[model samples]
Target: MNTVTRAHLCEAVYQEVGLSRNESSALVESILAEICDELVAGHTVKISSFGTFSVREKGGRIGRNPKTGEEVPIAPRRVLSFRASHVLKDHINHAPASGDNDADGTR
Candidate 1:
């Protein structure tokens, strides 16, 4: 139920890479900016063992208003989506929960 922020990522990099806080922050920011730029340029971004980020084009359609029962036109737009890789999915699915024991009953 916790959210991971850019600061969290920067801190993680700083801790794991022996980088200064400012350098870690800049590195994380640079990577995120590159990903955003690629997506904005209509290119898909794929990270091995992580996930793929892509933009999808959706056609305009008619939608109904829930309150007044009126029909409305919905504009066509591009949406960003993420598809997790199998490695990532398996890791998430098999990850041990807090306070849980392993198969051999060792925490």
Candidate 2:
């Protein structure tokens, strides 16, 4: 399994867009910062063909402690969640599996 990082995104942008490494990094950072800022401001962000990001508020609840069989209170708080768009889901579902070749036998 592999995880994509900010550095990977920057490198991709630099290669595909012919931007300097620093500029690519800055662009990625700026876009992420804007998303974060909007979420922090209680706004939902929807990117076409990608997904939607929003904050959800969960109510406080009583949870049990398994070790001592004690009950504990869970605080209410906001959580960030993502719902992938149908376009993204379809793309992922139709994508080639790991180690599999494409239709043209290309990786």
Candidate 3:
């Protein structure tokens, strides 16, 4: 599947829900800002039936320079991860997309 960008995502959602582009963009921005704030605060955001977003910290570690075959020190960083809820996972895993059926209509 092709990845959806923020601008296109806002447009698509607006079309579906009948919201204006401005409203959709603002709403998407607010949601993203809130998610970022929660991550910065070290809190996990769990959207029921969707997934959970959490921030994880990684300590500094050793690294390698493949070109020179030299070891280097890597800085620590924070990463965000999402864990899909069982319901979401089940739907995505078992449900076929539209127009997926054959001539016999057997998916």
- Residues 3-58, model 2: lDDT tens digits: 66898788778878988999999999999999999999989999999999999999
lDDT of each: 0.88, 0.88, 0.85
Sequence-dependent TM-score of model 3: 0.75
Tens-digit lDDT string for candidate 3 (3-97): 55798768767877888889999999999999889999989999999999998998999999999989999999988999999999998888576
Model 1: lowest-lDDT 10 consecutive positions: 98-107
- How much does candidate 2 score in TM-score? 0.84
| lDDT over C-alpha atoms for residue 39 of model 3 | 92
Off by over 4 Å in 3: 16-18, 97-107
| 2 against 3, candidate with superior lDDT | 2
Q: What's the CA error at residue 75 for candidate 3, in Å?
A: 2.0
Estimated TM-score per prediction?
Answer: 0.84, 0.84, 0.75
Clashing pairs in 1: none
lDDT of 2 at 45: 98
